[model samples]
Target chain A: MMDVADLVERARRGHPRAVARLISLVEDASPELREVMAALAPHTGRARVIGLTGSPGVGKSTTTAMLVRALRGQGRRVGVLAVDPSSPFTGGALLGDRVRMQDHATDDGVFIRSMASRGHLGGLAWATPQALRVLDAAGCEVILVETVGVGQAEVDIAGLADTTLVLVAPGMGDSIQAAKAGILEIADVFVVNKADREGAQSTVRDLRNMVALATRDWKPAIVPTVAARNEGADDLVQALDKHQAWLEESGELQRRRLARVRDEIEAIALTSLRVDLRDDGRLDTLADRVLAGSLDPYTAADELLA
Target chain B: MMDVADLVERARRGHPRAVARLISLVEDASPELREVMAALAPHTGRARVIGLTGSPGVGKSTTTAMLVRALRGQGRRVGVLAVDPSSPFTGGALLGDRVRMQDHATDDGVFIRSMASRGHLGGLAWATPQALRVLDAAGCEVILVETVGVGQAEVDIAGLADTTLVLVAPGMGDSIQAAKAGILEIADVFVVNKADREGAQSTVRDLRNMVALATRDWKPAIVPTVAARNEGADDLVQALDKHQAWLEESGELQRRRLARVRDEIEAIALTSLRVDLRDDGRLDTLADRVLAGSLDPYTAADELLA
Candidate 1:
């Protein structure tokens, strides 16, 4: 058994191994991990957590790799948590996301980790934000979280990040279908990956027109990029920087961060309560009534809470 | 301004207008609606809630319409809650779902209501399960909830239903992509809708293979149907009946129902807490921190809870 206190201390001092080990502990949901988190919680809040999400094949992984490289080039240490779909058959799988940024793995300034969704339905792996915290505590200046495309989980990502980037690809059928209204609302910045593709201009036009329809406040800028080729990577980074600056200048940045904190705290509390309810056998009794057809679910829930 | 107690009582006695009105109130999230829900909670759970979900254009709506027709043909009263995608411009949108089932809307034994997602990311509308409860309280023997497609929100539908049916269509690309493993694991019965399509047979074969890969003890059965022609509507209903029987015989029905009830209660509670947090202005503070690069979200979250 690893001493969580020792690990926390090492992680706080910028040990990559300690950071990696701490993230694994959190992902495993080991009982001892909670103690480590409690100790490390105070040391967090240093890194800028940015979330990137889009549909599959939207170059999210490549984009994330590029961002990490850009941040590192600017003398800032970077951490990347790339979430991928987990295979149901085998609970254990490789963090294959590293393949996209394999060239940067040997670079001391950049630390990248792949996370599996672990049967979680949302776009984010349940352990992602927590893992990002471990990196933040380890002194990473910027933490980038890449999520699986536009889905239920993706919506939650916006609530977790300081600035959220909604990535889109050209020629993925109707741009509107690819960029659903739900996703459009959350994007602080939109990136048109594969900008060299045929329908790039039209996709950009559609996004601008659609975004124009939704909000009268700050209009999100659409940045064109070919992440695989590293084309326009620097501009994308500048766009992110500009957005961050605007958020601070407008004071909306502080407002969004405050809201994000409240949501995370409430989410953690609710999750804990759910686990307690299940483990304490209250859920079993409620399930029994629901199955018997004698009590409907809504009523059973009320009784359980009572 | 109407009396909630009167509405609950009227709905209990099978008043369609009262049921419709109550659902509308709940969907609108009116404070007075909470009182009606509290009163009707005890009356819910009498009806079996069934969820039908699949990829877009997979004949989900058509299948739901046919299922309602078949169930009603057996002299059982039915309620249908069809969730549609909402437009970004106006929160209010057309209810195209009920149009497909127009034949049954006039029948006293059948009631159909279409719900828009209200910009919520999840497949089933946020107001969907609550609407189903209203129908359940109104003496509907079976309540069928149809989702727009397989997305982040689709996974949530399974947690709400006693039995879940995953619909798929032929030539819809990869079966695995169309019916992602996340949604597949929750399905009790799989229906290959639009079986008249050229690749229907192969789709069924692929589904059978996928079901075989699932590690669950009780294997879900795959049924084929031409929903438009109503060719296999009877078989689809029979499959649902068999699933119900399997649940009863295996003693798993009660267990699953209890789990669903517990989930519903927790979901409601968490939603309530989020609403409270938002109203108390805590969320705004957290959002502010997130926008400023100084505070990491996880630490900020801990502070908010403390």
Candidate 2:
């Protein structure tokens, strides 16, 4: 087994292999996770975490690539975590993702990683939190989590992000779909990507109208951009930065960070509890009793818990 | 307080109010849920549970309406559960859903209910299993759970469904998106709705191509339908019946139902455990120990379990 402490040191020094190994440890729920988290704990909390989310075919991968480039232009070290759909389709799509983002492949300042689903219940949702921490500990100034906004996997990304940019495209019904999916509630900023396409103005208008109806103090700004051609990307970055400033000035960032810590701790503890529940034989006993109808699940749970 | 035994009897006798109240008890996590489930247990396993899943604008409600009509033509009682998005957008859209299905609303043999999100972690995923039981015990020969294909909430619907029909439309990019979201894996049948629309044939071709790539024993059949025009709905129903017959002959239905029960038992047990962990002080003790750096979360969890 590789020494987690050594890996942490190497990762802190911006070694990609070490960084990749750390993420692998997180993804696999390795036995060394505790030691790694302990090592990483002190070095985290520095990265400006951004979550860029959208439905498939809405240019999410493209927008994420452009955003990384814009940030790299400002001399900031960037890390990207792409939430790959763990399906037969990902083999080709994730390859396309890598090829599309190849501009940053040789840039020493940028690191990009794609995560596939682990196929365990709640497993996909749990890995990103720890992976973000690893990136933060590795001295990344900006860490971006790119995910499709419409799935069950999108729920926990909001908890991990300091700012969330929702991407939509004209004729995608994405703006309205985002609203219906409750992704709108979590949007700190909305980007109407593919602005050069017809109906971009209408999409932006729809987003603004919905934003107006939101009762939150921080109204989400609608920024139009053609992400494919890298047009208006700086404005998108500026919007994200301004939102970050607003979060900090309003003390929401601190509150969000505190809640994130609580979430991280709870998630980790619950995952551990689940592990022990299986190994200790209590889950089987409780499940069997419930299945046999000898005990109600709630009552059996109470017994096991007690 | 309502009498659980009496309500169960009323529900089994097909009283709409009783069925509604039982579903409400499940959604609210009422104290008498155990009694309700015990009483309703024997009456379940009779209803054919079908899950209709798709993106927002793919005409899920319309297809559901047509499916119910086709089933009713054969004199089979039907139940419809619309998974309401439960955002601000839901208020209008849910109304639209009801209005669109109002044809069945007046049918004494049909039960159309809309379920809103419970706004808690895992809440949206938890309600369906119990509601399916209620509808089953209420003597609905077929129960359809209609949900938007995207979102964290849609994960467990496949487990609850005996047949999962994934709906796609022309220009939705839904075939590729379905493959990307791993929705295609859960589909026993694929419905290319709005068949007269442009690109419908290509969508059908894409689904067939992907279906051919899958190694499952049961090949998911692609059925084309124009749900609004009520075209090809009979063929969709025939496809569903064929799949159901295959499941029964192959004993897959029995296995799936057993797995569904096991999943229900496990999920309920876990939810109850989480409840007690927080309320009975175990979580606090473990959390504090981990937070104080005296122990890692894994070890603390082991100590708590022991």
Q: How many Å off is the CA of A32 in candidate 2?
A: 2.5
**Most accurate candidate by DockQ:** 2
Best-fitting candidate, scored by lDDT: 2
For each candidate in turn, the TM-score is 0.83, 0.88
User: Candidate 2, clashing residue pairs?
Assistant: A150-B151, A152-B151, A152-B152
Off by over 4 Å in 1: A38-42, A73-75, A84-98, A116-127, A150-155, A172-181, A213-216, A279-306, B33-43, B83-104, B116-129, B148-155, B172-184, B213-215, B269-306
Candidate 2's DockQ: 0.28
DockQ category of candidate 1: incorrect
**Candidate with best TM-score:** 2
Model 1, residue B56: distance off in Å is 3.2
CAPRI-style docking class of model 2 based on DockQ: acceptable
Task: Going through the candidates in order, state the TM-score of chain A alone for each one.
Answer: 0.89, 0.92
